[model samples]
Target chain A: MAQKTIAGVNLEVTEDGYLENPSLWTEEIAKEIAKEEGIELTEKHFEVIKFIRENAEAGLTIRKVGKSGIVDIKGFYDLFPGGPLKISTKIAGIKKPASCV
Target chain B: MKKILILGAGTGGTIMANKLRKSLDREEWDITIVDKHKTHYYQPGFLFIPFGIYNKQDVIKPKANFIPAGVNLIYSDIDKVVAEENKVLLEGGKVLNYDFLIVATGTRVDPDETPGLKGELWHKEIFDFYTVEGALALQEYFETWKGGKLVMSIAELPFKCPVAPLEFVFLADEYFTKVGIRDKVDITYVTPLPGAFTKPKATKMLGALLEEKNIKVIPDFYLESVDNKEKKIKSYDGLEIPFDVLTIVPVNKGDDMVERSGMGDDLNFIPTDKHTLRSEKYENIFVLGDASNIPTSKAGSVVHFAAEVLFDNLLCAIKGRELRAKFDGHANCYIETGFGKGSLIDFNYETEPLPGTYPLPGIGPFGLLQNTKMNHYGKVIFRWIYWHMLLKGKELPVENHMSMAGKKKS
Candidate 1:
């Protein structure tokens, strides 16, 4: 059980740096996490982060996020580069999607 | 009762056993399938083992588990197939006659085919990810490995899962980055192909991916031999690439039995009709999977699609009816680009991989030729499907032929 502190808040995280309790997530914590991943948060990143947090329990996928009207397929890639859904959801404070390989 | 003998109880053999047993009347047909080994492997899972994504337990299962009821499962080494007399010779000199024979003895990576590949450095310095032993060995090596010049090469083309070498490099990039040593490592992908992949469209996109990751591409290098003493691989045209650790996809060839049986091409692959999957030399025999010399990417998806057509054509052959089911060389594979994202590609004999949605038009849950986490999930989910629905010979939702409904035609 590794713990990480972000934005003055402490939370449990997995070996891969994903939040164990996504409900502990906050906008300030999201900014800190994204900064750690070498991303500077913008309005475009927040749109995907907000969408994934709202639908986190629904097993949202990259295609679902791209089709959710927040972003297109290429737009999703442009925002997050490599891991759009996984990184976005992690920033939004959600359990890592099980379907992601 | 007529006897039907199927060689090699791998993916193709297992599916054929289940499909044929259900189609043929038990009173009139006796089904028997044979293989050299008893353990069935999810070969695509082999690619993930070195990356620590899958383990030995995840990829291995008993061959007897999926072998359907009413089919005689024989576990032994194959000696040769006597197509002239329609009989098979086992290693112990036992003989079994067959009314219909199916050869599915898939391809194997032969390190011996390449000079110095099996030398002293073999599994220690030089590793291959094609087999379980190779993959596990590489896993152990990479665990404590300090980063340096890591070179990945393909000794030849027409290997199993053509996209696998590219996937290996992609996953390597992600793995090293996670371990915080990405800057310390230099990755190079050396291939015999002109680009990253076989098709034109896929090569362009995948090649760009290699560049983006800073993995150098050394294309059109025909491997002459591995110089273990110098710690470098020499190409035929005298290009040498040095490596701290060398991973290779060795020369793949059909089973040695195909060569001794005298029913194969120069590489021991059986001459199979591109569309019909029937033996070019014999009418009562059929070839499927990596054993057939079909101009398609030899992957599990190809085997699954070919099985559908082969089952129909085999049934028609038994009834003395004109064979009609066409294979169309439909093959698809998911390219794992690591970081929990993957890409999907779908193509047949005629079409190249295009950018669009797949298995549906306009409103796809899975995108094709585009890297997405959904495609990555689709790739991982296939392992379960391979074990359950595919080996059981149940129909999948995807059609057996290629469709252009959602593709961008340019």
Candidate 2:
């Protein structure tokens, strides 16, 4: 496995980019996360993003923000329960942290 | 010149800290918060972690992110709260003095409370996802594992999110299929409750969905112990369930500091008035979130609604006025059924989940009770709001009070 790093979010490629089966949950992915366009991830960054994703899936959208592009962010949500944290990590492109196993 | 000291910066503590920060004047009052860790978890995401839906980064962020600046954020474990003296002693022996107190130290998962649950297979064949390590480890374990009897159990109630185990089973069914092993894995969701959920209406809807997905639901089964050698879960009533991969939502109790300080009840939760969010005995003290003995789901919605009431009530307290703000036990939950859609339910102590459009009457881009892609979209979009809005103590477009504009009495 080749260990790769990006802005503190690490990715360990057992193969090429992403695994064909992804039967792999690596340490790097758990540490830092990958983020999407215009949003970058640092070790200190992901706290709030995961909060919204999980709470939204739980059926309570506690929105008090500007309405413009509010619906546009529908693509930003990961509704598959924990998908927000996973996607935030994915979009952040960071790997797992050291404290965890 | 009164000082308010809050112990533990979890959902209850964070919201209360923010509420008090806005309610009291900087000149007349001082508020200080204490906790050992730095990251704040969107705990509900733990259920999704094992299913590979939420990664570790999804559920976590620096604890400092949520605490509004200017309010003192003490990064240390509380040695004990001297309730009689109105002072908090930290692990480092630093002392925090308070004229008023709010005990929001949240719950802890006790795997040791369950016999053999924390033994040999703790993170191997058996795991608990209440924490980051447990959830991530299980997610990794699920990756290479073949399925047999995937038994998910909830040892007791007053757990953080009451609906999480059910959500886990539902998502697992969906996950196995997406991984091309749905037929190979047999999942049995084991619950301590007589119903699949707290409310009857939501239970009926949720239970039926469980059955519709070909997953079995065993209700009212008391968990006495787990037999690691036999790979079976033995209930107090003598029912035995076999499993290959076991996920346990361990016994959740309040932070030990609460018990050590003589501030909490038997389960370590602070005793407080259910509606007003006021500590029953102490006039200056208040409690909120999972830390309080409020009869509601410990999910984030309770905190959100409580924040609305509590922010006002705290102001009333500082002015030496009666706490008029009342929490109606309002809790709303989004139930994800997977496959690009989900169901939305909004209700409180008096209301059950009814079919209606939410935040808007019949016009929502999101639907309630019934599953919709729009509802799914609503669930997905909330992540942005959480980061940019909620923790900042800003007002959301949705009313602080649960709205009847979109919800029906039922």
Point to the candidate with the largest lDDT: 1
Give the 10-residue window scoring lowest on summed lDDT in candidate 2 chain B: B400-409
lDDT (10s digit) by residue, model 2, range B1-410: 67988877777678777767876788988888888988887776777788777788887898898898669998998889776777788987888888777777777798887788887998999988888899899989989987788998988666877766776787888899999999999989898666677566677888888899998988756566889899998765467899998999887788888888887765677777878888887787778677886777777778878877777787788789989988887877777777767888887665667778887897866787777888767766777676667766677777666677775557
List where candidate 2 sits over 4 angstroms from the true fold. Answer: A1-101, B408-410
Docking class of 2: incorrect
Clash list (residue pairs), candidate 1: none
TM-score of model 1 relative to the true fold? 0.80
TM-score of chain A of 2: 0.25
Estimate the Cα RMSD of every predicted model relative to the unseen true structure.
Answer: 19.7, 22.2
Q: Evaluate every candidate with DockQ and list the scores.
A: 0.01, 0.01
- TM-scores of the candidates are 0.80, 0.78
Tell the DockQ for candidate 2: 0.01
**lDDT tens per residue, model 1, B357-388:** 98898877788888899989998999999999
